[model samples]
Target: MIATLVIGLREGLEATLIVGIIAAFLRRNRAPLTPMWTGVGVAVALSIAVGFGLQLVEQALPQAEQEGMETVIGAVAVAFVTGMVVWMRTHARTLSRDLQASASAALGRGTAWALAGMAFLAVLKEGFETAVFLLATFQASTDTGTAALGAVIGIAVAVLIGYGIYTGGVRLDLGRFFTVTGVFLVFVAGGLVLTALRHAHEAGWLVIGQQRTVDLGWLAPNGSVRGALVTGVLGIPADPRVVEVLGWVLYVVPVLAVALWPRAWRPSPERVPRVRAVLAAALAATAVVLAVAVPSGGGADLPRTVAVTGDARSVTASVDGDAAVLRVSGRGREDQITLPASVHRRVARAGTGADQWQVTEDVPATDRPTSLTLDQLVGLFGRVPVGVSPSTNPGPFAADWTVRDTVTLTTVRSGVLEATRSERNVLTLRGGGLPAARTTTLDRDVWTVPPADADRAATDLAAAQTRAAELRLWNAWLPLALLVAAAAQAALAARDRRRVRTPTTTTPGTDPSRGPPADVPARSLDHAVR
Candidate 1:
């Protein structure tokens, strides 16, 4: 919720600021703001369309492909956002002036409508950016509602900022604002970079066989402060692939190089001392290095099986870590606590005893450091309901799942609970029967009722559900940040045009007004884009 709100609020404000600036500009110039509204509408509609399109793409994708898409978006977002941040910083004054001038020239078209159009288009540009950002984020966040709410708040704040700007009450040191936000963005981008890599790994796009990154579950989000921080920052899965780690490093390296290069450049005594440069570099290095130092193999989207005990005919128990789990609840008479297939057979086809009985206990083995498909992972809660498989919706259950150690229950006179233990088993439900045998790894929903502590099973399941919710929640909000960024870009552009057309005291191509900016010659905005 917080992530959604933050991204939404920030991005929303940006859009509102753009709208306000153009509206104010038109009002001052005695022009209709209709074109501005049209432009805004178009931009917003386009952004929405983009978001929906991306969502469709995400939904249509298989588990691995969905992950691959996520990875690509994160990488793209990091690149675009980081580049824009650096650009804004270097060209703040020049860009501002350019924006002012463009507004003036556009207004001169004598068509208040024309100037409004320019304003609208400017806002639209930002809108598209937001669209891309939101599309990426929507796929990553665990909740969309929170993200939507946050965006609304962001827009509201932006409106106020725009109003202040018009009334000459807003005096933001934009450079500083960008700097602080940029820093925050760096972490966010890093998270995305890490996340995308995880997706790519799942998709089989890149492979680094048999090496764990580092299991920092102690500090990792395996349920810790740092873990949450990392997750919130960029959908960063605690267990990352080599390629993912490499991607993160590559992306962040460039950002740091760009953001801190100037600060760290040793300057003469006459120049201002570079405290910020030193501090930024240290922070950047520390954050990355520490992340690297943390141990790998912390958490996985799927549960890591700890142990299981069952034989060919009937399997009785399972142990998830320290928790002792009971797999079969309907154990006939006698509390031997034994799952005897032979005895179950006695019950099976016996006179008037409901239906035949057959039991199988199949416990899966753990495989690591490899890419997994939807077939491999479950949303926690162990597997499906006892007897149910993951492939089918509420996949069929072999027998009554909730029975205690010994509870009387009816069975299908036909089927058998055939259990098989293997390192990687792929299960299939062929033609009719109970569970048509197929092969695969992983298990159906986990057996939640532990013979010892049923509550533990419930807790573990609940935690799994929570994690699933969180992953989706973060994904939903991630997009808002990008969208908000887009809006911010529009506002900055508008502001820049205003300054640009503001009739500077100097001539074109020559800065007599600011004394030619010392040794730097004035460059056109068009040139800057390249």
Candidate 2:
């Protein structure tokens, strides 16, 4: 709620400021305000409609697709907020002057309608950004009701403030106000960076750096007020991944520095060296820590056996480090299929839950034609099993399922099978009975398999981890670089302030050694200086 409120107040004030400036300018010229008001009204309606449309579109998508859409929205929101923050930081002081100038130009040209257009465009820009940002915040928040109420209150306050200022009933320090709010917005935007990356991973667009960086459960426990503030308002997940934390830091450090740095300050020669040294040292230290922390990755436990049972038969898959065995049994019949070491490694790399492999076999004439189709695989269970029947013609089957601790059938086709463990899984069948998709049970059971090569599996997993770590490590360099730059900027500002405070010994004369000219009296010289 606080996040949305700040967003609303800041954005609403900016819009109101613009509209008020234009309205006052028109009134001074004795022009009618009807066109300007009409434009503002239309823009407001469009913004509201756009927000609702985006929400509807999100609701219409499948879970994974919805995640993808959310990733896009979050990304766009981050961009919008960043741009708004930066632009406002630099432009807030000059906004009224610039708008008045433009309004005057329109009036001089007798194009009063251009003023209306300007009002429309300015309000629309702010409105569009507000809609997107609030949407992202609402999605991230645990309590939408409070978030909405806060936003409404914020906008109302902004409107009142804008009106008060326009009517000459209120005075404000616009520059100071914007500077304070700009810093807060930077924090909000940094949180958005984390949100976007999380959505990307869930959308399956990003898979690297999946390692847990730290356990933050204690910091953000479920169903607690502190948790809501930390996770919901601050946008930190209970357990953040390497990439998400990296993203947050990378965005926050430099952007916050920019927000806090004074606009008029310039770099001082004396401060640059110290700032550079600090920055360089930080970068080197970060590199050393990352190098030493690269995971060795050989100590993973054996993956749990996934036993999937349908109406007619039950299939159990046990995967050791290097090999996988699938056991199928029902109706007094048993069959076993073992994946080769290479196939097993590939499947393991795909992800946990073995849901994404398509295996094809080239059978010799004598080999039982191991190329099993969907129908043949189903036959391994039983005849005319309950809820499952052979279909003469199979239509395209594409559905997504979400269940806890449940085995999901991902795909079925000729000579190919793919399945995976995930919160959201897709099912695509070419020939299986529709009813067979009704119910499936996933049980955790132990199955003994032949001893396999542990070293090879460990090596594979380690290499993958190392690669992901390398990517994250490189990505981290950018933030460190920006941090150094911000530090230097800050050091320069401090130096300037100290210079201002330190008394100057030099006189106003170009030559401090030369007193007032011989012909000039001391009293006259002092008055001239003053």
Candidate 3:
């Protein structure tokens, strides 16, 4: 919820500022509002198309491939966001004028296509950025409702702000606004960078060498809200590594230096308000350092866990090093679990996002352990909680008590509390200071699975597969679409070039070359226009 709001506010502000600047220019120049509104419509349409296209393509991706797509897109987003931040910092003073000129030029061209192209590019930039943010959030959260709500609120706010600025209802200090927001943007961009790296790491584009810098869950559990807030925003690892630490530094230091270090904006010393604006901007400039400079992630908090079980009827079970469970029942095809993945095994994401055993020996179909190490046992110290029960609302399935040790897991399902020593055993085990909580459900932050009796889980699995297939199909189709779009763009560029060159048969002494080069290369445009 908090993340959605932050994204809404940040992206909303960017689009709002763009529309406001263009509208203000139009209203001042006495241009008919029709073209401007048409441009707005075009922008909106393009943004929607991009958004739907992304959703469509994403829907077809398999889980791991989806992850890969997100990682690559996120990395691209980070680069774009960072570049924009740096560019804005250097060119903020001239932004308003450039926007006005661009708007005016687009209008003078009087081609709806050109106008649409201009607006589409502007809004598409915002849309792509927003998409990246939303996708990153989606990977971390399971709440579609919250994300939808945030996007709606962001668009609504942008509309209001954009309209108000154009209609002259608000007098904003454009220069100061960019300066302050630009600094805040550094943090926002930094978050994007971190998020991108995380996705990339998961997708195998980056690697964290085998190392656990610290494990402090016993000292201070990291699942708390405060811990969550810090981790989500700052990219702090509960267990750090040498590479991740250095990677963060390599990204943030240069950006911080550029943001800070005093620079004069309005050299008009006579303008006191500009100085005040600078001071207001100073606050953000100074604070941006905290985005990356604060180093506090080196702490031991990666969950250390253990697994335990009690005696059961109709079944025999063994425990490994005070953690993990394995059970074998007569003729029942061995059922056992040495340790529950979490104190509560959450039902979402197919038990991912936490309910994971650091299975060292790789549990196979066989019931025998291959090898075990003391290090593995110590790691298991924080792997399980000492309790088990059917989550009151197990949905469709009856409560399953799975006994799994180093090798096999036999899970039993039951509906009600009819237990003699004969019913599937209610195994309870405890270690450490945690209260003896019951059940195999993992954290609530994860997506919930359907009850045991509920067929929804199967349906969800089917749906995920369907989406994965669709993503595969889209992957096959995207190259074709890009080809078409590229062809269109090239054709349009050529047409534009033709229209700009040689206004056809200039009279003697009236050199068409007298015109200033509209497409002048940035470095040179020596002589003045006629």
Candidate 4:
């Protein structure tokens, strides 16, 4: 609810401001308001339709595709909002003048369609942004109806504020309003970045740096109120992966620094264009480097063999890209099976000919081989022969066997585990070599074969590589494009500022028919609305 409300208020107010400026300009010019209002109505309806249509389409997609779509939409929303924030920050002071100038040009054309187009385009810009933003918000939220209600309320409040301004009953400091909202929106955009990264990961497009950085699930488990608030409004998960944390930090730090930086510390108008051009070029270059440098697959290679040794027996597994093989051997008996990592289990004969028997088990998928330790493998498949005295009939005997083993296995990454297993095994011996009336010791050993650990590192790496490729386009390059665009806008704004500051030469007896001199400062259209 809070998430949707914030989005509603931020986007709704922007739209309201645009409408107020257009309406005030039309009224001041004595132009008919009907066409402009009609245009606004049509744009609003279209924006709503687009928003709902997107929602319906998302609902119809498979879970993986839905996650991918959500990621794309969230990323686009963040970019849009970031652009809007920066553009508004730089141009809010002159917004009224710009709107009035556009209005004058439209009115000069002497066509209602011109006025309508101006209003339509202005309102449509804000409306479309609102729709996309709301869509992203809804996807993040658990309750769509509540999110929609919050948005409706926000729009209502904005409309009331707009009406009050138009009636001269309210005065809002546009600069301060935008600055404050811009700061808030920066955080919101940061959340969108985190959200997009998560969705991309879920969609199997991103795979690197997946280790959990922190686990706060004990405090705010998923589906809990606390979790919802944190995840929905802030996009911080209870358990966040390394990439999510890194992405959030990278996005929020620089964005907030730029958005909240003091105007006094900003570059002088004379230096603005130079600075903007330099920044733009640097960003473009960096973008190119990133595009070229990021690898196409998981940065690590899969190991050829993963082996685990026990007290008397050992198991070794190998994967050759597509197929997997597991070999278990002990007590002069060797078992080999051709296993595909895709399946959960495989059954094969462990011994040759008369000594052969069917063994059924599988290797569990793991990030590294060490997770399948030698002790675990020994506990699962180790067998040793024991010679007993003649008095000890070996038809069926149950004995407790304790085995201690140290296991070290390394794959693309490394992990280690040491374990001891104590178990009671029932054994049936068909024949035994023992001496009668001779002092002989009884030997006991247990034999069993359990599932081997499947090396899923390759599969996971492949998935990660695919995700990284996708992110290079959506997350990395898209943001760079937006930065370049913002830089260009800043450069143009600086040029405009320089032009405005230049003094215009005027003769003492200028013709009155020419109206006010071009040097005359335009009255604030917002003030006219109030």
Which lDDT tens digits does candidate 2 get at residues 283-322? 5566556545654333233333323334324455555554
- The candidate, 2 or 3, that scores higher on lDDT is 2
Cα TM-score of candidate 1: 0.49
Error of 1 at 253 (Å): 2.7
- Candidate 2 minimal-lDDT segment of 10 residues: 407-416
Candidate 4: worst-modelled 10 consecutive residues by lDDT: 348-357
lDDT by residue (tens digit), candidate 1, 1-530: 34444454445544554455456556655677777777778777877787788778878988887878877776676666676567655654454345556667787766766765676676666666566665556556656765666556765676676556545566555455556666666666677666666666678774432146876555555556576566654567656655456556756776866665664474443322243334444544554454455334222221222222332223344322222222342235212223334434334221122222333443332332123233333442344424434444332322111111222212222221222232323443332233444333343322222234223433444454444433432233223333444455455555555555576565667754332211111122112221
TM-score of each model, paired residue for residue: 0.49, 0.59, 0.46, 0.60
Instruction: Give the top-scoring candidate (lDDT).
Output: 2
Q: Which ten residues in a row have the lowest lDDT in candidate 3?
A: 521-530
Best by TM-score: 4
The best-first sequence of candidates by lDDT reads: 2, 4, 1, 3
lDDT of each: 0.49, 0.65, 0.47, 0.63
| Model 4 ranges off by over 4 Å | 217-229, 273-530
Candidate 2 versus the native: TM-score? 0.59
